[model samples]
Target: MKVDAISNDTAYYFLRQLGLERFNVKNLNAGHCAKARSWESKKAKGAWSMSRYAEPDENGEVEGVDGQNNNVAYLSRSNGNSPTEQLKKIGLSANKFTFLRMMRGSTLRALVPYLNKEQLLLAMRLFPKMLLVRLIGSLPKDMLLKMILHTIPLKKFLALFKAKVLFSIVANKRLNVREMVNGLEHLPREELQRLMTNITGSDTTQLNKPELLGMFRELDKLQLMNGLRKMGQEHFLEFVYQVTKKDPQLLMALPRGELMKVVNSMPKPTLVELFNLLPKSQLEQFVSMLPYKALLVALYQIDNKTMESLLVNQFPDLIAALAGDGLEAA
Candidate 1:
C-alpha cells in the first residue's frame, strides 16, 4: 500500500489489528482514493461507514469501486474478528495476495489470538503448509507454542503442520535421535513421539512398557523438561509415569531438578515404585533432590540397612530416631 494511502478502514485498521505503527490518517488522507473513500458514509459513527449511494448494480446491490473496495462490515462485528476477515471475504481474488503477502508481522501475530479453531484451519488451508510454517516459525516460540497448545488442537495443528511429521521422519532416518531432536526445534510433539517410537523399535500401534521406557530415556537426552513443563504438570506426570512404571532405572537420566518436580507431582504409590527402582547411586542423587515428604516416602521403600545408611550419610541426626525401629517412626 502507498505510504500516503493508508486509511482508517483498511491500512490503519490492519495496523491497529496488528498493533503496528500506522501513519496518522490526517496526513495520509491526501492519497485516499475517492473510490475507496465512497465505500464508507462520512458520518457513520464507527471506523467503517455504511452508506448506500443507490447506483445499484444489475444484481441490485449498491454500487462501489471495483479494485480497492474494502468491506468494513467486519469492523463492527464481534467475536474478536480480524478486519481482514471482511477483506478476505470480498477481496477474494483481488487483494487476497496483498492481505497475506503485504501483512505486517504484528498483524499476523495479532491474527493468532482471535482466530477460532475453524477460522485458523480455514486460514491454514488458504496457504501452503510450508509458507504457513515459515510464517508460524517467525513468531516467538513461547507465544506460538502456547497458541497452538491452548487454542489450536495439537492433533489438528500437526495435521496442518505436516512438515513437522515429514521432516521429523526424514531427520530420524538420517540423524540419531538426539541429533534430530536438537537439530529441529520446531518438530511437533506427536511427531516427536512417533520418531521416538520409531528409533526404539517400539510398536507404533500402541505405547507398551518397553516403548514408554525408551521414550523416557530418549526424551531425556533431548532435554525435554522445559517443553514438558509447558505441556502442563498433569501431562508431565503422566509422561514420567509411563517412563517410570516400565523402567524406573532410567529415572537417573533426568536432571535432579526436573526429576524432583516429576516425583513430587506424582501420587505416593507411583512415587514409591519409581523411587524403589532407583539403584543405590541414583537413589542417593534422588534423595538429595526431593523435598522432605517425597524423600521420606522414597526411603520407606528401600531396604532397612540401605535406608539407614542413606539417612546416616545424608542426615546424621535422623539416624538416631530410626536406629531402633527400622524407620517405623522416623
Candidate 2:
C-alpha cells in the first residue's frame, strides 16, 4: 500500500486504538503496516481482503482451492508440493516474514518526505525481500532497521521505534573496552594512543592508571621497554613512575635511540609535559636541537588556530626554538 493511503489522522487513530488495548505501540504500528501490505498485495492478485474474512486460518495454514493456497497463492511453483511445505523449504520463518513486512512499511514511511506516493509505493513493494535478507541473514534485524530509520527524516517514527527497540539492544550488548582498544592497532601511534585513552576512560593529561600499568607490564614482559622509551620522555617517565614505579635497572637499560623515538612518537600534549619536566637550559638546548620537522611536529601538539596566530606574528623565541639540527637552513 502507498504510504499516503494512511493519513496522519488515520495513523494516529490506529496507534491510539492499539495503545488503548495495551499492545506495544511500535509493534502495533508495525503490524498495521504488515496488514496493509498483505491486503494490498492480495488485492493486486484479485484475492479476498482480510476485512471480508473473520480471521486467518487457525492452523496458521493458507486456504487452498485445488492447486492454490492463500499464503503461496501468488507464487507459480513448478514442483508439485504443498504450499506450506514449499514456504518452509525456502526457510521463510514466521518471525522473518513479520520482520520483512515491518521493514517494508518502515522504509515506506521513511521515504515519505523525499518521495511521491507512486515512487514510495514502488520502493515499498520492491524492498521487502531485500530488507528481509539483510536483516535475517546477518545481525539482528531490529538493529539494522533502527540504523535505517535513523538515517531517514522520520524522527518521530524512529523515536517511538528506537525507544522501544534500539535502547534495549545497546543496554544488553555494551561495547567491549578491550576490543575497542585492539581496534586502534593500525592507527598512527599518536592517534592510537588517543583512541586507547578514550576507550579506557583516561583523559589526555592522565592515563587510566590500572589499564596503563597492565599495558606496560605486557610491554615490559615483551622486552619492548626500549621501544617504549623511543616513544618520548613523557611516555617514558609516565611508564616509569606511574606504571613500573621507576625501576632503576629498566631506566639504566633504556637506549638513547629508544628515548628519541618515543619522544618523536608522543602526542603534542605529552611532549609539552616532557618539556615542562626539563630544566630551563636542558629545555632550551632540546628546543634548539629540534629539526624544523620536529618543531612542526611539536606545533601540532598545540591548538591549530593558536599555532596559526603564532606563525603569523613571527614570534622570535618560537623561531629560535626551531633553529639548529641543520634543518634550520632549509
Candidate 3:
C-alpha cells in the first residue's frame, strides 16, 4: 500500500485534473512534513481530531463543536439530524470526485472511515489495483490496517501485502532478504517470474557481486542485520564485504555482539577499508558501539602497515607522539 511507485508529479497532475489548478508539489510535501510534526506533538498530549470537510474561515479557523455560536444554519440545511445523515450528505455532495482523487487530498482522507460498505465497494470497483494501493497508503496506519482487514478479501489482501513488500525492497525501505523471500511466495507465478527478470535481467544470468551490492544498497541497517543474521560464516564475511563496499552504514544496524562477531570474522584488509570509508563521527560511533576487548583484539590482529595508516588517518597527534614529536610540534 506504500505508494512510493507513484511520484509526486503524478499526484500533482491528478490534482490539477481534479480542479486544484494551483496545486504545488513542493508545498504539499513541505506542508505534510509540518503537519506530521504538529500531529506528533498533539499525539503526545493525547488530543487530536480530524474532520473530512470542515470549512475554515478567512482566519483559517473552524468553530469548536461546543461553541455557542455554532453554524446552525449550515447544519439545518445539510438535511438529516443524525451524524450518518450529515456524512451521507457530504459523500453525495462530493460524488463527482473519485476515491483516488479524494485520497490524494489531506482533507478528504478523513472521509474514508465514514464510507458505507456499498460505497466502499463502488470506490474499489472504480479504482485499479495500483490506485487502490495509493488509497491504502494514504490512510492513517491504524485506519488502513483495520479497513484492509475488514474490506479486502483474503487472496487480494495477501497480493497487496506482497506488493507492499516488493515496493519496500526496491525503494529506500530496503526490507531484509527473509521478508522479501517470504513475500515472494504470495505473488502469482507470472508476477514472480517478472520480478526475477526485473531483479537480474531479461537474459537471466546470475547476479554478479556488484549487481548484488547494488540491490543491497537499497536495504537499511535493520534489514542488513536481518539478512546477515541468517548467513553462514564465510558467506557472512563475503556479504558484509559486498555490503560495506556499497555502504558501511548498513552494518550499523547490527547489535553490538553481532557487529563484534562480524568484525572478528572479517579480513584485515576489508576491516581497514571499512574504517577508511566511515566518516570521523560514524567511526567514533562504530567504536563506541563495540566492546573495548573486541576492539583490542581487532587492533592486535591488524598488520603494522595497516595499523600505521589507520593511526595516521584517525589520530595524527597520537602518531606524532609515537614518533617523539612534542605536543606543540608536528
Candidate 4:
C-alpha cells in the first residue's frame, strides 16, 4: 500500500466518521472507568514519577542491580532476559494504565518495538507531543519509512514538520537524516522546489532546480532547519504557502502578523482564491487578521457569485441574520 493509496480524502473521511459518533455512557465498562479514574488520581498525586531506578553514574551505568544500564534497570528490575520480557514483567506487576503512567518518555520509546500496529497508532494519538517526539524518533528507520510509505497519509504525516518538533528531534540527536531526506523526496516537486530554495537561499534561477535539490541529500535535519531560519521572511512565506496550499486552515498556524503579511502580499484575485479555499471554521480567524480597509478591499473585488457562495456556504447564519435585519428595517 503506497502512501498515495491512503488519500487525504480517505483519512479525512475516517476522522470525520470517528467525530460523528456520539458518546454513550451506557457503553462504558464500570471496572475500566474506575481504573481510569484511579490512574487520574494517581497522576494528580504525582505518583507517576519514574524514579524507581537509580540514577546513572558518570560512566552512564546504574549501580549493580545485575549491571543493567539506567534505561533498562527499571523496566526489567535487573531480571528480564530481553526487552520484551522486561515489558511483560513490568506490565504484569501493576495496573496497566498505572504502569504506563509511571514510565518515562524514553522508556515508553523503548517499548515501541514491542507494540503492534494498533498499539502503535494508539500510542501516537494518546501520547503527549513531547513524548510522541521521542517515541517517533525511537522508531527504526526502516519502520518509519514503511509507515510513511504505506500507513500515514501525506498531509497528516507532514504535520510533524513543525519547527519545535523538528528542532527537538535534532537537539536530541535522534534525527535520521537519510530518512528525513527520503520523506522530502516524496513531496511534490513544486513543494520540494520551494523548500530547497528557502533552505539553500538560492532560487531556481541561481542554480538548476535539480542541482539545488541535490544539496538536500548532503544536509542533515539541523542544517536544513537552520537554513530555513536564515532564509528570511519572504522565502519562508512562500514555503508556508506551498505547504498549506491544500489545507488553507494551516495558515492560521503562522503568527498573526506574519500571516497577515503573507496574505497582504497577495494580489486581490489571489486573495479571493485563498478566501474560497479556506474552511468555514477558519473564516472568522482569516477575516480577523485583516484590517478593515484591507478586508473591504478584498471583499469588494470578489464577484457577486463568489461573494454569495462565501456568504451562503461559509456563513449561512450570518447571511440569514443580515436578511432578517433587512426585513425588520424594511
For residues 1-330, write the lDDT of model 2, one tens digit per residue.
123223334434433422322323343244434443454455446553333222223322222111112323222221344333333333222122222222222222221333233222222222223332331224233333333333333332223321223222212222222322232232345643553454444554454445543563444222332233234433332332322122222222233332233334334333333223223443333333222212211222233344334222322111211121111110
| Steric overlap count per candidate | 0, 8, 0, 0
TM-score of each: 0.18, 0.16, 0.18, 0.22
**lDDT of the candidates, in the order given:** 0.32, 0.30, 0.33, 0.36
What would the per-residue lDDT of candidate 1 be over residues 1-330, giving only the tens digit for each residue? Answer: 112113335534333322333324332232223323322233133332334222333422223212122323222232233433332233222222122222222222322433333322322232323333343344343433443334434333333322322233222223334432333334335644555444555656565445544555556443443344244333333433443334323323333332233223334333233223223443333233322212222222223344333222332221221121121210
- Candidate 3: tens digits of C-alpha lDDT, residues 1-330: 111212345435444423343433453343333332332344235442333123333432221111112334223433324323333332311211111211212222222333333323322322333433443344344333343334434333334322223223223343345443433333334443343454434642455544544554565555544443443343333333343334433423333332233234434333333333323443333332222212221122223344334333332222221122111110
Worst 10 residues of 4 by lDDT: 321-330
Candidate maximizing lDDT: 4
Which regions of candidate 1 deviate over 4 angstroms? 1-138, 161-330
Error of 4 at 116 (Å): 21
Against the hidden true structure, what lDDT does model 2 obtain? 0.30
Cα RMSD of all models vs. native, in order, equals 31.3, 31.8, 30.9, 26.5
Residue 107 deviation, candidate 3, in Å? 30
- Residue pairs of candidate 1 with colliding backbone atoms: none
Q: Which is superior by lDDT, 1 or 2? A: 1
